[model samples]
Target: MRYLVRDRMLAFHEEAWVETEHRQRLFKVNRKLLRLRTTFDFVDTEGRQMASIVKKALTFHHTILIKQDGENVGRISKRKFRIFGDRYKVTLRGGRRLRIAGNLWDREFDIADDSGTLAHISRRWFTIRDAYAIDVMSEPDWLLLVILAVCVDHIIEDREGEQLTNL
Candidate 1:
């Protein structure tokens, strides 16, 4: 399964639409404003809350929590002391661990589980705003994948902002 994630144009708040390859809406990503830590809510087309991604406050590394129905289902956190490309750990609820390794700058990466590559994410898809393509090879964990994509974008943006200030 694959999906197209696109950001809304000219919006004050962060908003995006998660659609099928045929342009059918599947989910909505809305950033909650005025919060201490960055947060996003993912809702189904019927307007039902599906999951949420929240950045942890005051963390040394980029840490994000994925919650479904108010329960922590997974997490995306940066690996420590990495000098090369970006790395992240995705821990599912039942202690299963997945590794996220890729180049954040190019917004291309792959997630692997014990069996093998579970999904591949790439921003090669053309769009007016930031957009990406998610190719799911295995059984789909839709919300988790979406949150990971958003987290990657935020992590890269934050790093760029820091570099700008240091200049």
Candidate 2:
């Protein structure tokens, strides 16, 4: 399966959606702001809650917990001391772990398991809007992968906004 993840350009907070190649909406991602904690809500096309990504504060590296139906499903944490580029350690449901590495600035990256590649994400596929493509390679955990993609996007956006403020 493949999906297109796009951010709302004019929105005040982080809001995005996942769409099919033909532009059919698949999931809606909503980020909660002005709250005690950071949380991202992922809802299906039919408006049912799918998962919640909650940020865990006060960590040496960025860490987030992926929850579904109030149960912890996964964890996403940044890899530290990378001199070359950014990398992430993703712990999916059932304790399956994967490493994500590539050029986050260009929005081109891949997730790989011990066996092989699982998903490829790139922005070069589209130039019209702030969107990226996720190509899932026969992966049954596509939903978790998409949510992780959005989580990475949120981290990048927050970092960019911080840079702008410091300028």
Listed per candidate, the RMSD to the true structure in angstroms reads: 1.6, 1.7
Candidate 2 per-residue lDDT, tens place, 68-156, comes to: 99999989898545687899999877778988888898878898889988889888878755899999984687888888888887777
The global C-alpha lDDT for each of the candidates, from Candidate 1 onward, is: 0.82, 0.85
Candidate 2 is scored at a TM of 0.91
Runs off by more than 4 Å, candidate 1? 127-129
Q: How many backbone clashes does candidate 1 have?
A: 0
TM-score per candidate: 0.91, 0.91
Q: Point out the worst 10-residue segment of candidate 2 by lDDT.
A: 76-85
Which portions of model 2 miss their true places by more than 4 Å? none
- Tell me the lDDT of candidate 2: 0.85
lDDT at 23, model 1: 90
What does candidate 1's lDDT look like per residue over 19-137, in tens digits? Answer: 87789998899999888988989999899998898988888877889888899988889964688878888888899999888866788888888898887888877655478888877
Error of 2 at 118 (Å): 0.5
Who wins the TM-score comparison? 1
